[model samples]
Target: MTTKPAINLWSSSDHAAEYLSRAESVPHRTEGESALLEFIPPSTRRILDLGTGDGRLLALVKGELSERLRSEGTSPRVEAVAVDFSPAMLEAAARRFAGDPSVTIKIHNLDYPLPDLGKFDAVVSCFAIHHVTHERKRALYAEIYSLLNPGGVFCNLEHVASPTERLHDEMLSHLDKTPETEDPSNKLLDVETQLQWLQEIGFADVDCHWKWREFALLAGRVGAS
Candidate 1:
């Protein structure tokens, strides 16, 4: 088997900095993220965020849940684990959630199998996971399936492979980037393959819920029964 390229950019400060700078500028990201949020069942109590860069998506989900609980006159406690291997990203996420006892930031490399963090009601990842090899990605999906409680959901907002070389180039151009400028860490796979992997791993209702060009929101649920 061919060895996968190491995700060097994730560990480098310059790469992390550049991504953080442009994080919010990715067009249509918010729309996909919003759609992902809507798919999460309201009764989620424990959530896990893989590759939680600066805890951005976690913060958004927490804020929304808090509001929902307040409006319903019910106190819903949410425990979240934010995992990232990048020192810079871990520090940024730690700082972002400092003094918030509900969140825990852990340094975890997704290239390997997940640690025993206990089961969660929902698991989320955003603009991450594409850095790992395709083989690792499939294994990780199976791991994620095992980590979820019954009826739990997994939502991944990912950068996926384009259908053709021309389309890939067009996507890069649309993002004002070139292949030479793209992150070497990216080992993007097609949406169909990922969704099929999820289904094969025993995640029910697997589907790509939303997509815009190369970005997609893939989700699945562990069966309740």
Candidate 2:
């Protein structure tokens, strides 16, 4: 079998540190995250968070689910697995979920196939996955499909490609940067192509659920028997 490309930046300390420092300041991220939460079925039991930087998105999702369950007078618990390649990010996630028996943090690079962590009711990712090459992204989506239980949902709050070079430059300009400053790690793909890939992989109801410039929330669900 052929080996896969390694996730380089994710294993670097500086890359993980830089992302964590700016993670909260990304424009329209919270809105996209909230929209992602809305796509997940409230009855979801287990979750898998891919490229879970500092476990931010997973924390948000778990917190929301907790509140909803509390209000409904139900004792539903969400078991979660948060995966990342960076040691720094893994440490941060461990600290973030310290003493929380519900979350399990694992260190795994997205460049390779997902581990046999079992199936999940919902799988989520945020501002991650684009670091992998386009081919790997497609393959990873297939792996995600295989790991989801029937009727499970996949929600990704992602960074997508701009429609034109001018628009791409404009987005960078808004962030006070240029192409040179753009993360070489990003392998941005168009939203349409990604949605099509999900559908082709047998995910139903696939769509770009929310969009703000180049940031978007993509969602889909597997059919239940």
Scored by lDDT, the top model is: 1
User: Compared to the true structure, candidate 2 yields what TM-score?
Assistant: 0.95
Query: Each candidate's TM vs. the true structure?
Result: 0.97, 0.95
**Once superposed on the true structure, which residue ranges of model 1 sit more than 4 Å away at CA?**
1-4
lDDT scores in order = 0.90, 0.89
Model 1 deviation from native, Cα RMSD in Å: 1.4
- Considering summed lDDT, which 10 consecutive residues are worst modelled in model 1? 1-10
In model 2, the Cα lDDT at residue 213 comes to 85
Write model 2 residue lDDT over 1-225, tens digit each, in one string: 222344356678998898788877877788998899898888889999999989999999999888899999997778999999889999999999999999999989898898899999999999898888888989999999889999999999999899899999988876667999877777788999999999999999999989998898988899996
- Candidate 1 clashing pairs, residues 3+ apart or interchain: none
Tens-place lDDT digits, model 1, residues 64-116: 77888889899978999999999999999999999999998988899888999
